[model samples]
Target chain A: MFNAIVSAGTLGTALDSVSVLVEECKIHLNDDGIAIRAVDPANVGMVDLTLSEAAFESYEADGGVIGVNLSRLQDIAGMASSDDLVHLELDEETRKLHISIDGLEYTLALIDPDSIRQEPDIPDLDLPATIVLEGRDIDRAVTAADMVSDHIALGVNEDDEQFYVDAEGDTDDVHFELDRDDLIDLTAGPAHSLYSLDYLKDMNKAIPSNAEVTLDLGEEFPVKFHFDIAEAEGSVTFMLAPRIQSD
Target chain B: MFNAIVSAGTLGTALDSVSVLVEECKIHLNDDGIAIRAVDPANVGMVDLTLSEAAFESYEADGGVIGVNLSRLQDIAGMASSDDLVHLELDEETRKLHISIDGLEYTLALIDPDSIRQEPDIPDLDLPATIVLEGRDIDRAVTAADMVSDHIALGVNEDDEQFYVDAEGDTDDVHFELDRDDLIDLTAGPAHSLYSLDYLKDMNKAIPSNAEVTLDLGEEFPVKFHFDIAEAEGSVTFMLAPRIQSD
Candidate 1:
């Protein structure tokens, strides 16, 4: 059995982060907290998220896995205000998740865990470049790039210790560069990669504008974006494969 | 030659009002003001709008008729903010309208006034019921009705001096009533007419929420909606043919 009360904003953000990659996921509820790891059907992107017990107003569990429809949960969460407290309860007999917010009760039928795809194993890699900055800066750069092309190149200038995003169209191009002074932190290294803007646009919505987003980069390799939520009580990491640049 | 500087909001509202009925129109520019009267292609609805010279920040014009594509003008207006000042100029030699807003100049090709539909004569009707209320209240009623049915019945209760809007769906219905206290002014008469919600929804966008909307109604007759713009310096009137009630 499991029950918890959490801020609507935190749950909504967490669901959004996972929903961008997969429609359904298996959320593991344990004494430690709740966690989900899933990958997109195209195998081009992956998301892993965890929320500690401290993130919730109240949490109790005996450790079990619950299959959830992230899209349905997101729809219910959309009705709640940011400050509203959401009550969650599991009905073992009916295998449904009950969510209550602002006097509205939504009962969602749980998906069968056996029907969902197995979670992807997180890989280990030595990424040479690391940059941390405000999420809004990256969001703005991606939005500007969308006006020009379908793909964007992210690169670090080792000599100048600057990070830049560039997108070139048939006749127009957009470029945005940020020096060390504009970033929260930077570990300069020679790194560059091209990624599809379609995934980045959806991921941007899940991230808060003011929060710090740490990016790990390598040449033509998958990129990792990590950020904290629920006042550091939760963390979300997204990895997206680079698109082959056809010159 | 015609040149004027008007608030983007006023121009946007004016364009929106006419665009609902016709894509292109003949704008009558006079020493006193500018006006346009056009009917929808289906001839089911008509819009009449006037903006006095006092509505513009600066006005200078010799009387002339200029053809305008309201859809194209609305697209240019979309680039401006509500408070921004939009400069409009006519190039007599090129027969084009130049709209300048936020450092961007959009030159629109004008159609010959001779090719456009002639303005319809406004029909004079002695409607008995006249109810004046906030535009938002009626807009909300229309929106609610849209969810239940495609047509809405607007009438006044002669006995209670109350104005009401009613809509019925296959299995559900919605009704909203307002007494004299809820309206700015109410002249109750035995009035009832059914109107298409599709037209009302589009027309609602042109009416400001806080502005007073005067509704003129008669049993099974065309309905008239009139509202002011540019702080009473301009006015817009919409007349829609009543839908024949099938019961």
Candidate 2:
């Protein structure tokens, strides 16, 4: 049995982060907290989310996994205001999830966990370059690049000690460069990778503009973005595989 | 020759009024003011708009008719803020209309006046009932009715001394009524008409919420809605033919 109360904003952000990667996920609940790890169907992106018991207003649970439909949860979340408190409860007999916001209650049938795809194991990588900066800075660069091209190259200029995002179109190109002084922290190294902007654009929507985000990059390897949620009571990590660059 | 400067809001409102009915029209410019009269292609609605010379910051013209594409004008107007000044000039030599706003100039090719549809003569009708109220009041009723039905009935109740807007669906209905105290004025004579909500919805977008609107109604007859524009420096009239009510 499990029952909890959390701020609507925090629950909505967590659902949004996972919905971008997959439509369904198995949320594991225990005395410690709730956690989810899933990968996209194309195997190009993966998401990891965790919320501590402190993140909830009230928490009580027996360790178990509940399969959830993220899209339906997102729709219910859309009806709530940011500061509204959301109550969630599991009905073991009916195998349903009860969500309450304000005076409205929504009961959604839970998916069978055995029917869902097996979770992916987190891969280990030795990325050499890392940068930390405000989420808005990366959001701005992604928006500008989307207007010019479908793919963007992220690279660290060791000689100039700057990180740059560049997009080249048939008729025009957009480029944004930020030095160490402009970023919160930078460990510059020879690292460059090309990635599809489509996934990045969707992921950008879940990021809070003023929050700090850390990016890990390497030559022709997957990229990792990490950020805190629920006022740092929880954390989320998004990993996206790089697309092969074409000359 | 014609050269004038008007607030972007005034110009936008004028274009919006005409674009609702027809895409192209003949604008009459004289020493008195600017005017347009056109009917929709389906002949179900007609729009008449007039703006006095005093409405513009500067006005000069040699009386003539210029064919205009209202949709194109709307696009240009959309780029300007409401308070920005818009300069309009007729280039007879080039047979084009030049619109300048905020250092951006857009030149559009004009359609031949002779190739456009002939202007319609204003119909004369004797309506038994007239109601004057805030535009927002009528706008609200229309919006609510749209969700329940495809057509709405507008009438005055002599017994209750009130006016009402009502819509009935297969299983649901919506009604809004206002008494004399709630209206600016009311000439309560027995009147009722059923009109398609599609046209009313489109026209509602052009009506400023805070302004006053006068509606004239008659049994099974066309309805007339009159409102002021450009801060009361001009006026616009919309007439819509009533639909045959199905019992």
- Native contact recovery (fnat) for each candidate is 0.00, 0.00
- For model 1 chain A, give the 10-residue run with minimal summed lDDT: A167-176
> Tens digit of lDDT per residue, candidate 2, span A1-247?
8999998888999999988888999999888889999998888888889998999999988898999888777766665678889888998998888776643445667899987777877687879999998999989999999999999899899899899999998899999999999999999887999999998997888788998999999999998999999888899999989999877
CA deviation > 4 Å runs, candidate 1: A102-104, B1-247
> Residue A210, candidate 2: how far off, in angstroms?
17
List, residue by residue over B9-125, the lDDT tens digit for candidate 2.
Answer: 999998898888889999998877899998988788888899999999999987989998888888888889999999999999988989999889999899899988989887888
User: TM-score of each candidate?
Assistant: 0.54, 0.53
In Å, residue B198's CA in model 1 sits off its true spot by 18
Model 1, TM vs. native = 0.54
| Superposed Cα deviation of residue B32, candidate 1 (Å) | 31
Where in model 2 is the C-alpha error above 4 Å? A1-247
lDDT of 2 at A114: 83
Write down the worst ten-residue block by lDDT for model 2 chain A. A99-108
| Candidate achieving the largest DockQ | 1
